[model samples]
Target: MSRYESPRVNAGAAKVVLIVLIVLVVAGLVAASSVKIVDAGTRGVLLHWSAVDLTQPPLEEGLHFVTPFADDVINIEVRTLKYERSTTSASRDLQTVRTTVTVNYHPEKEMIHYLYKNLGLDYENRVIQPAIEETVKQVTANYNAEELITKRPLVKADIQDEITDRLNEFNLATEVISITDFEFSLLFSQAIESKVEAEQKAFKAENDLLRIQVEAQQQEAQAFGIANANIAEAEGEAKAIRIINQALAENPNYLEWFKTRAWDGKLPLVVGEGGTPFIQIPISP
Candidate 1:
């Protein structure tokens, strides 16, 4: 008391400053809590006392304010989302096939409230995933393993169409749905591969047989053409020989050079029976 006069006054001043700081902090908290920021690539669903306003739609990216105690904000992603599912199921042929499917989807902004109200927050886990699985099962059940592999594109389209139609009733927006891979049992797959190889080999063998048959026919035709040509040539030559023989008989001297040429540069060792001979001997000095 002697050294520090009025300890009570100092205590009161400290209490006053503490009260002011507390008030400032409470006010700051209220203000900060009331203001909410919606970022790009997202939308906010506003509800008053848990009642959504469908007419106004979700607020776009910006700052918004509401009574902190009375209102709430639900942020939803408006962009595309991908879901991959792998499942093993049976085909119409009772063959078990493992399949992987991809689905692209997003919530319709206009129908967001309906989806949230009906299917709730876990729609992907609940509605979309189950719908995809069921649709895939149904589609695969109608097709065989070979069709699943060869006509997969068409199968995917059918699956997408069916799933989309089913989910649309629940207010989900679907972009694209496709089957990426179809895997069968190891033994079954090997069997199919072997069968395909055998079919291809059979086709090649048939083609080879056809080609060989065609070649043989072509050779036969060529041989026949050559035989006919030779026959015609021989007949023409024979007619010419007959005419020449008649000329030789009509004028024997006229046929001397012709007869010499007919010997083809080699005199006959023996004369023909009943035929004139043309051999001349020259005297040597």
Candidate 2:
């Protein structure tokens, strides 16, 4: 009897199915909106109907639940980020200086909502960049071009401190700042190079002069030693001659004895015309 349903009943059934489908779809959307996932290294800033909620702390990493369809979560990365900028400024000496700097920073997690409210996500361009540029320019202007190159560590510290203090006012934490590169006008660079080259040459010249002086001193010492040795030998020879003379003057017989000791057994090859031997004996008086 009811093999086929009436068109009215079929129409009513179709309406119910469509209504259920619509409800399920709405429920799915609501559920999706209710859940929020704050990824790792990021914090969620909750907003109520487009208004930032300042009363609550930022939602930490992981799943969170919020009012469906009425609340929104804005993710702000709390992890370290790098920002690099190239800036041109003037040194105290009125020299044009170009500098490239890098800054590692992150927003304070507790104050992320405020950061989002005030500077939004593009804070790097709005705040940090300008702060870096201004701080570099200001700090650079305090040092001469040569001082900027020579006192690089001090310059870096000054710039970093300035940037840190400036960013702290906006709840952005600066981890570290690096002065990656420095450049000057070609003429200035060449002048610096020439100055350095001159300094190096001067140092070498000083060292060479010292070495030469040392060598001269060594030569003088050697000559003095040799002269003393020659004088000593001459004095010894004269002393020997004086001792021999004294021996001979004290006793003329010593001469005969010395001659006899020095003579060989062989006789003289030549004889006097009178056929007498040329050797004569000294008589002691």
Candidate 3:
């Protein structure tokens, strides 16, 4: 071939190569647009021309095909998700209460399309957070601020049930709910502390009073026993003296014999004028 012809052929071949590259790139773009991947724990919602396709069920996890440039797949997570919020509300006793709550939830796989259509990707904010806030307020109003703290499990259950029921209206499933914290006003907290202190003091006082009463009763019983013993001893001594006197009265000679037995044989060296000798012999009876 002539040199000129060779250049034209080379240029032609280059043009063909460029065209093939363009076609391949366009095909790749189309393929990429037509294919969708729904990840694990997620479901795909198809949008036809920017509108949700309600007639179709959500696509399960894995690869899916769609019409290029006319359809789109929006992946919605159906796995359990955590939502935490701090809210303030009023109790039945009109006390302000602050509560922090955490909820675990997931979108219903079958209802993802409807969920996306209604609430969009920000469902946690639009539905869950508001639901938790409202539910907390509503349930808190049914109890006093003290009860909210003391009966924490019951409060958590009430709030959970309310939130679950509310979120269910949006096609969301609740897995678990937790009440992380409950806060009362400073004044209320101080009041509770004071009340507890007072109760403790009262209990201590009552115990002390009982102890004192028991001690008093024991002392009274001891005194009564001592008095009874003294009285019984006095009566026994009096009875003995009466018996001895009766014996002496019944026999005058008995008295003389007692005196003789009691006397020692002795004489005084100097006797007083009106005194007799210490040794006295009783006259023969």
Best by TM-score: 2
lDDT of 2 by residue, 83-164 (tens): 9999999999999999999999989989999999998889988998899999999999999999999999999999999999
Per-model CA lDDT versus the true structure: 0.83, 0.93, 0.91
Q: What is the lDDT of candidate 3?
A: 0.91
Q: Model 2 residue 98 lDDT? A: 97
Q: Write the per-residue lDDT of candidate 3 for residues 58-139, one digit (tens) a residue.
A: 9999999999989999999888899899999999999989999999998999999999999899998899989998998999
Output the worst ten-in-a-row residue range by lDDT, candidate 1.
275-284
TM-score of predicted structure 1? 0.81
Candidate 1 off by > 4 Å: 1-16, 257-285
**TM-score of structure candidate 3:** 0.71
Candidates in descending TM-score order: 2, 1, 3
Ranking by lDDT: 2, 3, 1
Query: Between 1 and 3, whose lDDT is larger?
Result: 3
Q: Write the per-residue lDDT of candidate 1 for residues 1-285, one digit (tens) a residue.
A: 755767878889999999999999998988886887777777787777888767667878899997775677778777898988888889999999887888898888777777777777888888877887888889999998888888877888888899899888887788988788888999889999999999999999999999999999999999999999999999999999999889889997756555455655565577656763445332359
